[model samples]
Target: MIGTLLTFLAVGIVSIVVVWIVLSVVGSLLGLTMTIATFLLFKVAPVMFLGWAALKLWAWARNNRGFLSAKDRRWLERE
Candidate 1:
């Protein structure tokens, strides 16, 4: 019957609208997550890299020169 068909059409339209709204909300949330993740990566990467480099340098220095001596500490304390 025409009434049944109309009812189906209306239900289809409502469902489509609801699905569209849900998809858009999900899309926006995904975009926000990506942006925040990228921002954190950029902000944190340099500090992390520098820290890693410093650790490597310290290890190298420790291996090459050994630990700081008492003379070195005394010289530093003089200043």
Candidate 2:
């Protein structure tokens, strides 16, 4: 009877420790994921948006060239 009780207690303690370790690992992974997401939002997103805007501006300028006269081009160059 005593041996059975001791075995049950040991198993219960081991299961608790295992659960605690698993939770700690999961929390660390969640923190790392949040950090990477924050970096992408703050650092990478602005540069990507700026590149997109620059491409659009360049396309508009290229399309605008067909309507301008030579005199307008000269005036623009002088300015």
Top candidate by TM-score: 2
lDDT of 1 by residue, 16-74 (tens): 99999999999999999999999879988888999999999988989687677799889
lDDT of 1 at 10: 100
Models 1 onward score TM values of 0.71, 0.77
For candidate 1, the lDDT comes to 0.93
Alpha-carbon lDDT, every model = 0.93, 0.96
State residue 33's C-alpha deviation in candidate 1, in Å.
Answer: 1.7
Candidate 1 vs. true structure, TM-score:
0.71
* Pairs that clash in candidate 1: none
Query: Relative to the unseen true structure, what is the C-alpha lDDT of residue 13 in candidate 1, on a scale of 0 to 100?
Result: 100
